[model samples]
Target: MAADPASLTDRRLLSDDLLATVRGRAAIHDRENSFFADDLADLAGSGYLGAMVPSPLGGAGLTLREAVHEQSRLAGAAPATALAVNMHHVWVGAARYLHERGDDTLDWLLTEAAAGEVFGFGYSEAGNDLVLLGSRTEARPDGAGGFTFHGRKIFTSNSPGWTRLGVMGLDSTTDPDDPRIVHAFITRDAGGFEILDDWDTLGMRASQSCTTVLDGAHAPAERVMRRIAPGPSLDPYVLGIFTSFEVLLASVYTGIADRALALAVETVGRRTSMKSGTTYSQDPDIRRRIASAALAMDGVWLQIDQVAGEIDSEPDGRADRGAGWFRATAGLKVRATETARYVVDEAIRCSGGSTYFNRSELGRLYRDVLAGIFHPSDDESAHALVAQSLLGPVEA
Candidate 1:
């Protein structure tokens, strides 16, 4: 016999009770516009923060695919919380991706994370649309084989709890002829960086992804991780970061769509139409809309799972793992985020006007889903990458 779902859930890091606790706290955090401190504490206590550490190191040692599934579950319980926590997972996953393929550059990161240090993604900037290809932040050599960063970063997730912040800047002084994009980590106690209290936004307030201001923030010689040319290349480190980020990011939004669909199904089951004198579940139009939403959601996981598996299997490199990796990752990110927006809209339409209230779960999801459009590989970029993959880049 198949094991009872409840028993299985009990064995997981995101156990049912844990999710309930997190779910119960999501609204409060959103309402107060505060960080999910309790949720983070609980997750850390459950060993979730160290889930990417190797099994021999006392971590769960989940594969990329397994971690994606767990992220979806966490997101279904709390989207903002899950989205913020995803930054930590992304770094750990990248380290694991590299380590499995004989790259020990980030082994210290893995070791530090397992020892209870949390990391945050601090790469986003206000106007650096180049995404990882370039940076507006300045990286000046400290002359001791180290570097000092000077600039501002937006959407600095896990700002409240990160012991280490991953950052990148352009090291123009290193070589006048060629400025390299330098990636490094700055510790919270290192000084020179401040978290601005400016995260208030349309939604996802619980994340407290405030703006981080770096004024001569220092990354010690050993802390400087990578220095690549100021444009796109299929470098292994670049591919590892892209794969981990895109797949995990997609999983979070997919979970939002999943939750919205479930809520819609529950709504239809109880809603009755005045003209039909029957539940919305019996209404063909309602059923059809709900089906469309479910179908869209159902289509996302397989692609996400497949891509994640490919990344896990061939961390030697995503590009080498398969052709059109940029296309695959960019396409999946756009697909999942857009699907989430579509499904949340449908769920609201079926759930009645009460869902329009701020107090409604669907309302929160609607606002949260909108944030998806702005993540890396936006709609236009994703389409461009997909087009370039098939038809080649637009002529100069």
Candidate 2:
């Protein structure tokens, strides 16, 4: 029998084996394996991947708080696999957000997504940073109430599994007399589009963050996700979407640190050094390192929990006084991600030369956790946004 998305969500929530499912077959996702082609089906079937879809669309209607806990658990099990799953959930939540806005385009995307379909984000342009306001992709009218997308989208996450691509570009052909249109479009399986699976990187190799080239992809009128409207602005669902993305991303880092700490503890328990008559665990230096990492990881978890609670309380995006909450969430994302990198590095140091061995799980975690800090949300730009919002708009 086919499992209903909503029913599956309930099962996942209530099951005592939820942690076991996330931490499944960890050895296969370790360093020597280096990929997780075998795990996606299990993940999809487990209802771990499609929880964001709404009830009307046959989804679980679970909130961002649920996603954070699940993502963090997955990260602790296998950071690489968790990172891939994180990308999928990010798009799923965003799709649900757009779908709830009562627009036809969003409605179609939401329906498809609810059927266990995947959408990839193509926001990172080539030779560009997080500042997408200066995006070069051009959308020109095709004169039949449709538009043509002619540009390249680089660093598209989960390229192979994408049933639809969410694109953001400027409508250059809009009448100059009117305001410049920054439009978000959703195109499904366009033939002209190509996913360049050339994402061979040092870390998170399983992510498949490939480059997608759009060679005049025809976006029909129904495909446009939404146009920026002049009004009070901000959608409650969009707030949920952003918060979900940030918290989940942070969870991945926290999980990485958790796993690394575990491996460090295990290694210390088993290995003994000639310099000392006892195991590494007995060494005060190693114990101190472990203690520091533990403290940092705990601090990060506290921030994530607090932020989730605050976001739930203030469902609306318009928390004028809640700018601090928003900024704090962003800062937490950056801090947790950065702290994970440090934790992994310290764990490696504590593990010594043996940490470099591919057999060591800590070695794999080190590579995976480092990638989190390089994501757009981990950098100064994200922090600056928080500061600007809390400190008032800065003069250019």
Candidate 3:
């Protein structure tokens, strides 16, 4: 019999079972470079997708901190699966946060998620590094209380499974002098979008975050959520996105580091040094490498937990609006991703030649962790944001 989703109230129990089932299928999906359809089904069926929805709404009602911790645990089992699912979680978690702030605008999002609708983010575009600050996609008004989006979105995760896509586009037609970003939700059944089979990549292969082309894709007026000026505005939507995305993204990478360290420890504890006839775990050099990785990972995990806890405790989400929150989140993203990359490298080093094989977990982790560097808040952008926050904006 399948496990009961409600019984998964204990996060650790859910994670242990999730790891067992999802991890077993991870290698197969990775080898085929296919989406984790089975994993998605398990997560959705187990109510993991609606983890942030209120229990009264027939969902798990998990706090951001708890949800992120679960995400970290899941990633340790299957990084790609966890990463792809993070998109859906971000939407639901954002909606919950907004609702807590007394904003009913995103109530429909929570309702839809509770009803088993999967939400995927489509805010990213090729050559568009400004993130939510700008968009290349055009949101042309349809006069019938709707918008027709025309452009392309890259790295759209959960591409094969998302029923509703949360997307943003620029609407310069309203006022050429002052363009605003129009955020809306587009249904998959809408006629104008296409998902390209172009996700083949060096890492996180199972995510299948394919390129999405939007040619006059329509979002009904009712689905239209927020419209705010480009660049750092104090919009609630922007704050929610930044808070949820950065924290969840950091959690995912942190989980990768956690798993990598565990694998290294296991390998080191078992490998006997031919020269000394003792296990490498006792070797000072090997021990030091593992300890260093552990300490670094612990620091990142603490930051993630702290930030997530603060966000969860905020009644109105106002705590996440300040420049301090931005700096902290940007820093968190950089530190978590970079630390995961470093830890994965150390894992490979300590595991020796065996870990270099394609079948090795550490080998897969090395590639999966690389995807972290390319996500929003890349090292350079993150550093610039942090610097600007501390010293004030640089004079152009």
Candidate 4:
């Protein structure tokens, strides 16, 4: 008889041996400004890639709450690697999130993910603040139960190894006034797309998130995940995508903050203050900053963990997924990312000038943490979402 799936833990899926290799290679990948190919291979081989696919479907059988914990741990070891792989998890998690709530539109995702078909997120576009609600890309129907996409996608992470890409485009062929946003997972062999090798950045260099140009990329009718309305509507697929993306995105930053705090603690213990005649750990001011960061982090973890648990427990999408749900999800992303930036700043301030060097881990973290501000549910949008939730939409 097969072993019980419930008995499987994230630690088993993410073996200690593989994590050590991933941690060791983080600096190398960053220094080279390259994608984590080895890391991806190891993760895929170790079953970490299919962690959310469900046990019966040949996965490690982890829940979003459990995956959140595992993602935090992975991010702690290598932030860019964790983030790059997080895209894959986002789609799988969304599929699982939707499936649990009686929406089986993307159930094929579980089977594909289990069989080692890497997934990448290809929705981000330059200056497109309407993120996910509308698309700058065009999705013209092919008349044969398919559509061809034409547009450019920026920050296409996991570009080096992804076999399947989840992208979106606007389809005006149906009632131009009320267009639809086509969501689909297109395979690499689908052709009509190009991956531009340009991903050098200030930080998180290891992610190697290149630009993708889709001249006529196509997705078959079977693979078209969703076709949501143009404006904001509480579609089940939309909710799942937003919730999964934000929660998992927050987990990466949370891990960055966690690692930065640990490094700061170690630094304080090692550094001897010339004026105080004692280790910085004993200094009142240094201790205070660390404590403050810790306090803020408590809320960060609570927000992320609670949301993940809520999704797992209340897996019904057809009812009660209101503004409050979106509000909490968006708020968590904003808070967690902002708190991560704060923690990293405190860590650097307490660690001393040595950490300012280019090779120093703190310096890398300081830069990596800044990238959080750029992700969706940005400070502006998140604040607006919160306000809109509290007070109904403003009059025209």
Off by over 4 Å in 1: 1-11, 315-319
Clashes of each: 0, 0, 0, 0
Which 10 successive residues of model 4 have the least lDDT summed?
1-10
Residue pairs in steric clash, candidate 2?
none
lDDT per residue for candidate 2 within 1-396, as digits (tens), equals: 011224323434324364566456555545343446556666666665567667777777766656676676677776667776776677676565455444334555556666767666676686655433445676777787666666788767666666667676667566754433344555555666777758777677666777878777776777765554222235433343456677778988888888788788888888898987789999999999989988888788778877765565453543333335446666888998889988888889888887788666787787778787666565777767876776866778
TM-scores for all candidates? 0.95, 0.84, 0.95, 0.95
| Residue 147 alpha-carbon offset, candidate 2, angstroms | 2.7
Q: Give a tens-digit lDDT track for model 4, residues 1-80.
A: 11122343424567667778889999888888988999998899888888988888778878887887788878888999
**Candidate 4 has what TM-score?**
0.95
lDDT of model number 3:
0.87
Please identify model 2 stretches exceeding 4 Å from their true place: 1-35, 95-108, 130-132, 177-188, 229-241, 316-326, 390-396
Candidate 3 wrongly placed segments (more than 4 Å): 1-15, 316-321
RMSD to the hidden true structure, all candidates: 2.7, 5.2, 3.5, 3.9
Per-residue alpha-carbon lDDT of candidate 1 for residues 254-296, written as tens digits (9 for 90 to 100): 8888888888899889988899899999988788889888888
